[model samples]
Target: MELQNRREFGKKMLGTTLNYFLLESLFTSQAFASSVRPVATHWAKQLTEICNDLKLQKIPPVLWQQQVEKLFNQIELPELLKFIDFETLTRGFDYPDLGVNTRMVKFPKLDGLPEKTVFIRKIFGMKKGRAIIPHGHSNMSSAHLVLKGEFALKHYDKVAEEDKYLLIKPTIEKTAGVGSSSSVSDEKNNIHWFIANTETAFTFDVIMVDLGGKAYDIHNIDIAAGEKAGNGLIRAAKLDVETALKKYGKQHH
Candidate 1:
């Protein structure tokens, strides 16, 4: 009888081990047998999971976009503000002309957010008439959620690339308000520009770049100087960062 009992106990342990491995593989792209989890967080753990999947390319881009948009729409804005101490960060902040002030978002130790995250998270602040400039990204994915005020948000689909310009057409242009959100990837809506429409506007950003360890680039454009191409397209001349900021940053009219 003791021998039989030992056999039963061994079977039970094997079953439990299989169950654990199954769950681990399901949660991550890599099988548990070989994979190590990148980072852990107590605050915004769900966000971290999504970003991990994004970096791993475990989900489709459309699905990722939907997930990010739904996440912010469902976020408890008030709770988030309190958690991040938004008021303390933005209070008495000096405004910049035509550009945004970028602040890194750090989850407090008390909140159990690790010093390192799966990806970059940021808060961008802009004064009225200021803009984040027109830019396109490659080999990256990002999401922006409006936390306060409003922005004249615009998006353009990449048509073609020139030696010195990006040919794009407007795909989205709207006054995005609090809780409004959008996602960008090279696959869709690769280009974006944000102009603050209210006294002050703030957006919380989720950024994941170089998912496949490929070279990534940001193309800043001088939209004002671009000649209109046919079919509502514009051939926006690319500009260096300093030149783009100087030309496009002041009080976006």
Candidate 2:
């Protein structure tokens, strides 16, 4: 009986292990994994210290909607095209019950922008919650737009590295209210990280611009407060506000 129990336990463990490996593989691509090195060196190495002191605040939804709508109206799509580079925007995941999707769009005639690469799409259910992991990117800048719902966004700056990715730092938490958006441009060096802080789920939209190439990269990072409970890869992205403004904000700016 003892021998039989041991065999069954071993079989179950193996099955579980195999299932996990398959799921991870299905979600992550080899190209995306290799892209991490550049993001780590560029954003993590350059801005990790300076941004540590920066804090974040919340923006209300009505104000957010008005601002984005105003910016879109003043900025013509073609004029907006000049600063346009790789665009990746996602919306969804506020309630957990709603489905989500991520899409990539590329433009060639934009001039000075990379060819055959860019991601543009509507996303849903790709983000949620208040607590997120601290992370940085290599060659991307991002703009987050909240089409609907209310949310709190906390910004964090990496202070020190416990080990390659295990970060220790002070955080700046802010709320993006509802219908509002926040953008971070990639400095020649610095990038910022953030998380959602709403009680229930909220819906929002985001646009990510890849400055370097068609590929986007993110490092799986863990933070001090969120680590104890094992919430890994909760918050992350590829780009900063400055880059967002310079490359894509001409219409709004």
Candidate 3:
């Protein structure tokens, strides 16, 4: 009876050990599967289709932005990074004096498309407290994706105009981090400001320029703290580049 009991205990120990190994193997397989990189050509093909649709459909600004956002959502960050030349993109960041810098990813121009088909892709590298000052786009649609670190995004709608001041109502405000994305169009959330909330941050942007017009213009606006309307929209004054930078420049270390 003693021998029989010892054998039963041994069997139980073996069963527990086997179960642990089986579970670990299953988890290892899953981790390896998720780490596999996607086919790079697939993204190129998808981008081509999006650009072609934009040219053919000439969709409304809001709808066009939605389509672009949907397509971008399908791509993973690792897969998208495959197309960018990080060595060139990070060159400026290597030097401290450059401060905040933006570099474009060189992509082959979409062939067999009309001259109006415009594609612009860029990466912005910034230090803490640096900002892309409040600005609005004209005749353009774009998307901003946070690749690393955190950012504060504030968006506003142009509601009323008073001389040089534009009455803008705050629309959306949120904190975004890795894998997060936001979009803009002439009709929705047209004006926005972005500030880095970490020691360093990187953001990628894809822009379709002059979708329905000749040129796309970015107009920067100054916040009017003293001017507020009953409707909740605040007044903003436009500022030149020099003045805007002085007002919104990054904090010094």
Q: What lDDT score belongs to each candidate, Candidate 1 first?
A: 0.80, 0.38, 0.72
Give TM-scores for every candidate, taking all chains together and pairing residue i with residue i.
0.77, 0.37, 0.73
Please, what are the lDDT tens digits per residue for candidate 1 over residues 188-232? 898999998899899989887776778778999987788999999
Per-residue lDDT tens digits for candidate 2, residues 1-253, read: 9999999999999999999999887555443434443433432222222222121113332233344344534433333322222123322223322212333433222223334222233333233442223355444444454443455554444333333443333344566554455543333112333344343323333343444334555543433324431322322222243432233222121
What TM-score would candidate 3 get against the native? Answer: 0.73
Provide the lDDT at 23 for model 3.
Answer: 97
Q: Write the per-residue lDDT of candidate 3 for residues 207-235, one digit (tens) a residue.
A: 87876645887777887342787687788
Candidate with maximal TM-score = 1
lDDT (Cα, 0-100) at 182 in candidate 1 = 93
For model 1, the local distance difference test gives: 0.80
Ranking by lDDT: 1, 3, 2
